[model samples]
Target chain A: MTASRKPVPKPTPDTQPFWDGTAAGELRVQRCAACSRHCFYPRPSCPACGSGELEWITASGRATLYSYVINHRPAPGFEDDGPYAIAVVELEEGVRMMTNIVGVEITPENLELDMPLQVVFEKRGDMHLPLFEPTGAGL
Target chain B: MKDAVVIAGAAESDELGKLPHLSTLQLQLGSARNAMADAGLTKDDIDGVACVGSPIQIAHSLGITPAWLDGTGVGGSSFLFHVRHATAAIRAGLCHTVLITHGESGRSRVGAARMAMGPDSVLGQFELPYGVLGPTTTFTIPALRYMKETGLTHEQLAEVAVAQRRWANLNPRAAMRDLITVDDVFASRMVAYPFHLLECCLVTDGGGALIVTSEDRARALGTAKPLVHVLGTGESADAPIISQMEDFTSSKGFRLSSAAAFAEAGISHDDVDHVMIYDAFAHVPIYGLEDMGFLKRGEAGAFIAEGHTSPGGRLPLNTNGGGLSYTHTGMYGMFAIQEAVRQLRGEAAAQVPGAEISVVLGNGGMFASAATLVLAGHRG
Candidate 1:
């Protein structure tokens, strides 16, 4: 049986490079040259310094679990997956993004706050989606 | 505009909760008409309108051409922002009278527009792809972090719902009126980890509107309806993304907005008699009390668990049961204001006795924006 389709990220012109980097197995985020700080969920100008002079940098792909929820009801495309972890992880560079935590059991005992996690890409539809896995992530 | 602007009229839709018969526009118009009637005025008196929906459409249907209009759809708190903006406009001679309305077919989705954005939108790109559905998952993200940092027990979080339910039991209009215990909260379905079904808010269909006009105009009406003054108002926005909120334990928007309003009104925590903090989830009021400076950081959970905010508590809060037991349309700020107006008018089903000063704190997006209103029954 064919698997139920899930949501896939459609990259815009501004975010096409980030998607391209993900497909090539590198996590990318924008760093502002003006303020020397990083930004995520790519946009035109820097959020901190309002500088359009931003450059894409390959991130370390290392993040710590900042916060998350175990969603009981899955999104439309995620019918196959049971209750899953929807996480907000703070990157080593100090920007945060919403992604799913995979590669471990979805239990309170298994997922701990501030636990170390590393990014991994999972292909869905025609795009690669970034997800996280626990490095030593247990309470 | 302290004591210069007053809510001359305030009301909810003719009937709230599961009104498949009423479309969103119908709900909005019905409430607006009721508010004008309560004010002893008509559409001809309204020269300004504000709402999350199309103000032009509402103005045209109401048969009044507004001199000023605002379609600020920041979030639930957008109505609070409207009151603030209307106060400024009246003081600036932009408009003398304003009507602010809210209606959401949240449960039935009657005439409610479905919003869809392409992959380029911030949320579509960062949040949607991760199998996140809606507020149940997104707004629930910060609780774990808050608990971790402040050591707020899961029971304290559950107690927020229980306390609100106590108020709901007193109000005839509240949707969920059955008295519930913290264990009942724990036993209710787990919509998300660290959040039980009871800890979440009720999803009901409703609408509310307010009529704001100059104090002179309100007095000239000669109607005995008590005037609820717009003493001080403040609006502010913070994180666009929930994950980006500066702090997990408190809302920056709430802090700034309420602080500004209180400073403008020249009052301290001792002066407030009632409060209606928008409670989309149980944890929100816990965040609201602390962030608004009613209590120190990390003190709200215990304060609530101690019965300080329940019926007859020292500081009564959410007397209309709040969004938890009260009606929660998709955007809940309008109802919060409506309750404050009711308490000020001595008309609330669960009225706080001698509630002269009512503070309504509104939350917009997923902790992204906030607007605060300090309302007084009489000039201080």
Candidate 2:
């Protein structure tokens, strides 16, 4: 594990594929073979139907900004990322995830609700963390 | 609608503020002893022991080898669930008397253990790596979205801190009791966007405990204080991680738990005279008020800003100053329940006149779980 400001995730048997997909610059989610609903944070069984027949599917890498905050206080591993926008994005696949909003200045004026966003990957030793940036500046 | 279970006694570990000398276990033992004494019972009489942390350790240290033990760790709301479980356990003859305890050295870090999210856990892998810190960082996401959607202003959020301080001023036990204004709240340092320093809960070291028993057993003891009956209780859980919350603008856990509790209690909003909503942050109460049906959606911010939740308001909420101004030792549900008991007993520092019914709500882990209890002064 490289010494990063944030803690690195150690992939488990159930979540390895999700992490592997991120490293390959693709957002991966589990789809219940029975329910056909997408699930983020990969699990062995489908959350909606509780079926063991699960399949990994690539996400569109597009999302809508649901909610966010500009954290003024620095998190231990994210001291440099302080005053950054921590956001919850609703993926096009209907799943939501937490990520940082980058490629724009961290300010209230720059961040807007329901804004279009696209996923971008950053390399952190042995892992590629997914983050989001506005599709077009303030669009 | 007779209450089957009653709260025999309730007490906190020590003073509200910092106490560097006491360890977490010491705090637990102190409050447990105080609760037992308040209930007019000895350790030998407690057949059940339940807590959020280390029931066996608390039981051993207190020399109580309970026939029933529950160490359900669901966050601050764990204690409320403990009471709910204790109620059923007592009625079913699983135990005669149940004692629940909570203690945390949040400020002093005395006897505090470092908790690590398992690297393989969803939180450790997906959320933690993104620098989504503790509740303070995670909670801001929903609060910001709530403001955008609900049109709640920063001043309105500030009003939550101002109103709670008014209640705290009347209580000597409150941690920050010097009257604060909406302006003061805005002037205070910002922890996260839309959250002023004062808008957040005070990090104090403290613990609270509750003693519960069957209605018959409570009557038999005949303590001077009126028995606080457990009329109804509820518990629910959502995704543990903040990012995966079912809804960003509202809490499904809060809605489900309070609804179940109110339904079981068979009471409408009018019957509630007093309330205690866990205020780990200023936004929490707003969420509680709206989701619990005391007010409609997007109405709590204005309701609180208009002084509805204050002392002179129609509904007396967080009479103990809440986690925002009172003591918050990480998990704040126990203290909320303590205040509800006080109101029902008519012994609270800022007592609500003729307060016969009290509703106490507790939230755990960034809206991950919620528990509500409808307590009454009498059997009905």
TM-score of chain A of 2: 0.91
Query: B1-380, model 1: which lDDT tens digit per residue?
Result: 24388899998998988999989999899999989998889899999999997999999999989999999999899999999999999988999899999889989999998866566687888888887777888888999999999989999999999999999999999999999999999999999898889988888888999999988988887644799988888888888878778888889999999999999988899999999999999999989999899998888999999999999899899988989998999899999999999999899999899899999999998998899999999976
Candidate 2's residue-wise lDDT over A8-117, tens digit each?
A: 77888888888899999999988888999998877778888899999999999999889887888877767665487888899999999999899999888888888899
Winning candidate number (lDDT): 1
lDDT of 1 by residue, A12-124 (tens): 89989999999999999999999989998787899898999999999999999999999887778777778899999999999988999998989989899999999998888
TM for candidate 1 is: 0.98
Model 2's CAPRI class?
A: medium
- Model 1's CAPRI class is high
- In order of appearance, the predictions have TM-scores of 0.98, 0.97
For candidate 2, list the clashing residue pairs, or say none.
A5-A77
- Given the true complex, what DockQ would model 1 score? 0.81
